[model samples]
Target: MTYDTFQPHPDLASLVKCYWTLEVPPAADSQRQRIVPDGCIEMIFTLGDDIKRYTSADEFIIQPRAMILGQTIEPFFIEPTGYVNAFAVRFYPYGFTSFVTASLHSLANKETPLELLFGDTPAAELEQKIIPATDAKERIQIVEEFLFTKLKSEITIDNIVKSTVGALLETNGVAPIKSILKDDPSKRRQLERKFLNQVGISPKQMGRVIRLQTALKMLLNRQSDSLTSIAYESEYYDQAHFNKDFREFTGINPKEFLGHENMELSSIFYAD
Candidate 1:
């Protein structure tokens, strides 16, 4: 397995975290990888064979060649086919809305194919042009050009929603919605509605996921032997609180996660 990451265009930096590429050889024996939410949307393009997303035993679905993965509230599993090669653009919590017109709230927590968002003709044409690019650099350029030209006209944030998200992130998911909305309770409710539409999870839920995400990295990296220390560092109230959240998100405790087959490949990327 080989992976690389790149910076996004300056104007898009706030919304897009980075562009990333991953290539796996044919014999890599792909394992199921879980992608957890991090307060962002994403756009992915496969350069080789297809990828599969599994929901349960005996259920398999092929993802679109090019798709937008909306903010996730929970983990989703993916397995790549032989010689898997792909490039993905990861959006910041606020970045994807700039390029889209249909309420940003409408795409939350789901993977919508590009053709569904853009009209078939336009999306089809863009896919043809991008898929032909022989290298990752050229492919990145194609995506950047499309986004820049499409989003040229308008870039504005819904103030109330932005503030709510800001508060949630700033507090490391420990901040209560009431505390965040003390300035305006009405705005808090509005934020929840908008989050449901655009991000697929309420501000509170996203906050918890973000906190767990922090601890997940620390555990995989062997940063500390004591779960209590990691819990404290990640802002959990106690070891038990950390364990509960971990089980909810990953269906396993911290100890089991390290040696789990399903988590093997993903563990490497988060390791120190």
Candidate 2:
């Protein structure tokens, strides 16, 4: 398996987290990989064999060749049919809304084909250019151009939403929404409405996901000697609180996460 991430263009740096690519050889004993939410949206392009996203214990569906994976509230499983090669753009929590008119809440927890968001002709053209790109740099260039064309001229992110997201990220998702808006607690309802339309989840949900991401990296990197210490560092109430949240997002306890076969792909993502 090979995974790498590249910096986004300066003009798009604030919105796009990074452009990433993954290539893996077909394995004889591959197991279904678990994918957990990470508080970000992704635009993905599959360049190799099709992959299957399990809808249930046995049912599954082929992921779109070019699609937008919205904010997922729960964990899901995916398995490669054969070789795996993919290029994707990881966007900030509020970034994608700047380029599309659809309410993000409608896209939560599922994959929507690019055509549905960008329309058939534009989406197809972009996919064609991306499919034949010679390298990650070329693909990045292609996607950036497409995004630039779609970017709104005026600021699309509402001030309250951007600042709240900023506060959540700056504190590694542990900051309380009320503290962020101590000056105006009445705005809580307003923020929730905006979050659903722009971020696909409530502010609290995004915060929890972000907090879990911090703890996940700590586990993946072996930064701490124990889960209790990690919980303290991550601002969870206690080891029990940490374990419950971890299980909720990852569908497994932290101890079982490391060295777990199904976590190979997820580990690569968070470890980086």
Among these predicted structures, which one has the highest lDDT? 2
For candidate 2, write residues 231-257 as lDDT tens digits. 999999999999999999999999999
TM agreement with the true structure for every prediction: 0.90, 0.98
**Tens digits of per-residue lDDT for model 1 on 165-189?**
7776776667777877776777877
The 10-residue segment of model 1 with minimum total lDDT is 263-272
**Candidate 2, run of 10 with poorest lDDT:** 176-185
lDDT value for model 2: 0.94
Task: List pairs with backbone clashes in candidate 1.
Answer: 15-92, 15-95, 105-197, 105-198
State each model's C-alpha RMSD to the native. Answer: 2.2, 0.9
